[model samples]
Target: MAGWIWRTAIGLAAIIAAGVASAQTFPAKAVHIFVPYPPGGGVDVLTRTLADVVSKNWGQSIVVENRPGAGGVIASQAIATAAPDGYTLIMVASGHATNPFLYPKLPYDTFTDFSPISLLASSPNVLLVRSDSPFKTVADIITAAKTKPGGLSYGHAGNGTSTHLAGALLNSLARIDLNAIPYKGGAPAINDLLGGQIPMSFNNGPESVGQLQAGTVRALAVTTATRAPFLPNVPSMSETVPDYDTEVWWGLLGPGGMPADLVAKISGDFVAALNTDAVKERLGKLGAIPIGSAPAAFVAKIRADYDKWEPIIKAAGMKAE
Candidate 1:
């Protein structure tokens, strides 16, 4: 019995020592961060910016690959099947949590197939109208929608996007009917809003900030529970509806079953990078608030969003387009 105990202790120590050594030498070569959307989008730009900083710090190449298709399902599937090593990573948007609800036949399980590493940043979707439009606040919109059900319409990027859900949440909470107009993307929706084709739009910060800055559009309220830091003057929807809160968020994830130590190391590196002045400044200019939350915190966020939006999406009958 004594001899057996000694042998088991020695084997356990060897396994732990090997894990530490592997984590220390992780990414011995180039690492890839798969972006689910096309190039030039917020997710792509944020991933590239962070990769640049982190790669320089580690003296390793971090390649960002865009695999856009099927409302991010294509890239998500890739990340789900990739090796569990730190070499394979993905920068996912808020849609990651909702995708499971939108696409019922996902190739991989949303919660189980991927490991949450960090919640990188969040940006509120702004509710906007032409600078000259009469609607000035959430109360105004709610009143109008209630006065004339199905009369007020708002444009969104697509059918099952954050922008779409923002508008949906407003409609539900305010108990008003606002005709939802789904556009191919936010750019076109913003154009329609400017052209008088649509009365208003729910647009992400990156796309709406420029218009707000240029004074071409007026922001009614942001889609967060609190006002966004980048748009401090704007109020949050919850301030009016009491519980209306939604925002565009991005995060990092690796394949499931990653060693806890390696997960810690990767999360530490990214969170450190997020804290740097240079990274903070750049992300600020893009209208994003860097979160750098812990893995457990990120996991909680994913679950929270998953639970929060499932019923909303189902009742609204939202699905991938």
Candidate 2:
């Protein structure tokens, strides 16, 4: 009996050692990143950019699988159920933070069940309207909404989206009853605004910068705390409503249980990719500022944002589409 017990213990120890070793020399093959939105979106843009760069660095192929539905529920769930190898990762946004509150139940937990790699970048949203509209500034829009509650209307990418949240925060801070109209994505929302179907909409700096310059739409304010570097003249929404801010940010994450060494290596290489001149210029044109945060810091931020956005989502009666 003693001899049998010793052999059994040795076998178990050896198996565990092999698993750890395998994880250490991880990504011996191709890796895939799930982009939860359609192509041409901000998250998709950055995820593809990282995919190309990371593939070269790893000397292994990297794939971006776009699974667009339910405001990221489908892709997020897929990532959660996948094997916890460093090769299986996802690029997520603030939707992951607010989903818990917006939806009654999420297929996965934003905090646990995943390993945070790093926060890649963020784009400040610009409040835009037709250049010929009467509302010339953020204050004008707020005053109109307050004076006539439930009268003014705004549009966004979708219900419970970051842009919708920005509009909600604005309504809450300004103590107005601005109505929100949801579309499948940003392009449609911006299109309707330009066609005079809606009074205004919140859009990314890159998406609206061209229209603003072309004299198609006027930028009222930015959601960031201060004016955007690209649009230096427009004041931040915070200037009018103190402490109010909202924007879209993207981060990289792998399923939980990735080996520490492998996680550190991938993270370091991804950060290095951020420094590349081509990537910097491309991201600049998209109006995103890169942030190469540590794994632990990214983990803490995911938790903090999940908590902070829950109440806002619940109060605004946001629901997943």
Candidate 3:
């Protein structure tokens, strides 16, 4: 019995020691982080900024690859099937949570195929209209829509995107039927708004800032529980309609089945990078708030967001385009 107990203890110690060693020596080579959007978008820029800082600190190169297609599924599948090593990671946007509901068939399991590392940042989607438009606030839009249900229309980037979800949530919470016009992307949607083709738009901060600064568009409100720091003067939708909150968020993830020790180490490194002044300043200019949540917290966030949007997507019949 003593011999057997001793052998069992030795085996357990070996396993723990191996995990520790792997965590400590990780990234001996370059690491790759896949971005689901094309280069120059918010997700790509954010990923590259963080990767630059993290790679310097670790003395290893972090390569960012953009695999934009099918609303991030192609890139997501890359991470889902990659080896469980920490080297293979992905920077996913809010679509990561809602994709499962939007697409009937996905090559990878949304929740089980990848391990969430940390929620890096979140940005509000602004409710925008032309500077000279009659609608001045959320209440005005709601009243107008209620008076002539489905008479008013708003444009968004695409179906199942955070911007689209923002409009859908407003419609549900406010109990008004505003026509939702889907655009190929936010840029064209904003172009139409400026050209008087669309009355209003639900656009992210990065895309809206240029027009807002140019005095061509006015922000009615932001889609968040609280006012965005970048747009402090604008009210949050929640203030007008209780419990209305949605934002564009991005997070880091690796293939499932990663070692707990390695996961902790990688998450800690990214979180530390997110805390640095350099990262905070850069992201702030882009209208993003750094979160740097723990692994468990990130997991909870992903699941919560998934649950929150699933019913809304289903009821609206939103599908990937």
For each predicted model, how many residue pairs clash, with residues at least 3 apart or on different chains? 0, 0, 0
> Can you write out model 3's per-residue Cα lDDT over 20-85, one digit (the tens) per residue?
888999989999999988888899989999999999999999999999988999999989999988
Query: Compared with the true structure, what per-residue lDDT tens digits does model 2 show for residues 1-321?
Result: 999999999998996786677656766999989999988888988988878887897789998899988888888888888887677888998788777877788878877877888888887888998989999888898889888889999999899888898999888888888899998888899899989999999987667767877899888899999887778898899999999878788998877776666677778888899879889888988888888888998888777877777777788888777
Q: Candidate 2 overall Cα lDDT vs. reference? A: 0.85
Worst 10 residues of 3 by lDDT: 205-214
Q: How many backbone clashes can be found in candidate 2?
A: 0
What lDDT score goes with residue 265 in model 1?
88
Question: Which residue ranges in model 2 land beyond 4 Å of their true spot?
Answer: 1-24
TM-score of each: 0.95, 0.93, 0.95
lDDT of each: 0.92, 0.85, 0.92
Q: TM-score of predicted model 3? A: 0.95
